[model samples]
Target: MSINSVKGAAIVTGAAQGIGKAIAIRLAKDGYDMALNDVPGKEDLLHTLADEIISQGRKSTIIIADVTNEKSVVEMIKRTVSELGILRVMVANAGIALTIGTEFLDTRLEDFEKVLKVNLMGVFLCYREAARQMVQQGTWGRASSVNGKRESHRDEHLIFFKEKKNNHYRAAAEMKKYGITVNAYAPGYIDTPMARQALSVNENLSNEEIRQQIIQRGSSSSGLAVNLGTPEDIANFVSYLASEESKFMTGQAVSVNGGVFFG
Candidate 1:
């Protein structure tokens, strides 16, 4: 197959780093062209990722847009279909952890709203725009959201996560007739830049300390995997979900959290 040859095209939000970056790269390797999305100021990272994907024999484009904005999301989908081919996958992975360590009473209203705005509303917009494009194109596609599940220890952001999961169910139902499947990937403590940032908040922890903290958290559960999961762990599952193998899966949030929260 030529470098431009592709199974389809996928748009992964928050593709600049962490799980989103992993998913984008994996999808590209899976033979799908990639449209990488991230907020402004992450152009360097996105550009570098796009180049890497192109180097791997797949077409790639960088789309800088804020998922929280409806117009931006629409434009992103439009540009993606315009640049790449039909949209086969939409990974709504852009999110923030502003209230990660804050208690419910200590969390400010602005912080809570910011979290919802990015994590909840962002996923909703991506799902809406992507579903619209898929329905119009009459293509079988997959849409998945990250951080859509709440962990027991992360109860402060319960509403945000719950809302994201709800969006998945609703989107899956509405898009089912159009041959589009919407799902959510609930990751436990994946080793990612975001996780490190969240863990290091107001703490004097080194990189190794953070890694050990994540390992301890995952080990607390009697899961099959006792170590912290890498971003590729979630991305590999996403690859399966985005493929024809998961045609029967929809309206569900699968847990990739190392058995931390079993379904």
Candidate 2:
């Protein structure tokens, strides 16, 4: 299925791979001209995905940017508008998971700062810039979506990460007057490249075993049994919030984790 009418341009950060890539492709399929952003080194992956988006008959632009840098993020948003006309949706999906296990206690201040800068401050920059443009456009269906993923058990950094997510609430309140709805998608145990990378660092377990562990963990918390989520699952929910149908909903984080978590 394809969305026939264009819904305006969407900027998705970290769109080169994993959940970010999936969201970009899904948004393109849903009839949004996409500005796909990632760090400078990931240009090839961004271009490949941009090609796929074009193949789907949607306009796609690859923007090499560092989300952690305020100037780069501001430019990224500016470029999107200059290239795609108007910005209606902003998906702040670029984030880094730096702490694993209980290593939060031993995590260096530098490491902690790096994660916060990329995951928290990055979202801040993207949201502010996007909102500024959306307000100037003075249009409906102006939306800001963010990603909230499952946290590893026993990770203290997860606490800070979750705290950052509360920005959606404040952003929603502030941007609603501008006709922009701010919401978040909290996903759990979805199979993505990031999950594989995290699991790969565990030399004790094979990939298959790690996969099953994830599935089992998800099944235990979810009403749906023995199933893991996909990146498209989160994207589909984002599609709704970005549309006119979900206009009444704001300041909420919708859980797309198959009943694993409630918000």
Candidate 3:
């Protein structure tokens, strides 16, 4: 069935690039009018993505806002509801790694603070605002977050991973009465620009070497076939979790990391 036959609206932060971009596109294909957001100054990219969604016969709006800024995020949520109808799904996909590849002792305090602000605080604001709208609408809704698999050197990564897990339960508990499901998708070794950039920082390996290493490591780690994932893999999972078919599930962190680690 064509995804465009589905219904509702969704807001995806950091929708200009990487997994966020993929998710936004997938949702549009899934028949969700989209409010695509990215950090300020990414207007050109957002415009391009908006055009793509419009081409798909879904209403698309470019919402340039800083997820870390309270005022901006508030405006983003409000503008989305005002322009795109009631919010049906919230994809909190905007995040950053400020202290990657740095030693604990060498990591700057400012960098750590910035990471927390964007990765943790940003998700919190989006969830809060989206939940408010969902509760007011009195319609069932879904709030899904994009999370990562464990990366030892990435302190920011660990923080967001924990947030994704813990907040799933917390949000589910609080929002159950409102008929909104809170869940997360944990992706491992997806071939996105962010993943490539993170791997590329290892100066010891060439680009092809980095790619091979990622594939090998993910393959060896997971019980499934030794294949890494694409951004669409995660997007597919998000589409299901956002759909009415997943109504019975909540407070769950579904891992799409090729079975890398099992709980």
By lDDT, the best candidate is: 1
User: What TM-score fits each model?
Assistant: 0.90, 0.86, 0.86
Decide which is better by lDDT, 1 or 2: 1
Off by over 4 Å in 3: 1-6, 148-164, 201-208, 213-227
Cα lDDT, all candidates: 0.81, 0.76, 0.79
After best superposition, candidate 1 residue 5: deviation in angstroms?
3.7
Candidate 3: minimum summed lDDT over ten consecutive residues — where? 218-227
The collision pairs in model 1 are none
Candidate 1 deviant stretches above 4 angstroms:
1-4, 150-153, 201-208, 214-226
TM-score, prediction 2: 0.86
lDDT for position 143 in model 3: 93
How many clashing residue pairs, candidate 3?
Answer: 0
Give the TM-score (vs. native) of candidate 1.
0.90
What is candidate 1's lDDT per residue for 56-120, written digit by digit as tens? 98889999898999899999999999998889999998988853455666878887788778888
State the lDDT at 186 in candidate 1. 83
What C-alpha lDDT, on a 0 to 100 scale, does residue 236 get in candidate 3? 89
Q: Rank the candidates by TM-score, best first.
A: 1, 3, 2
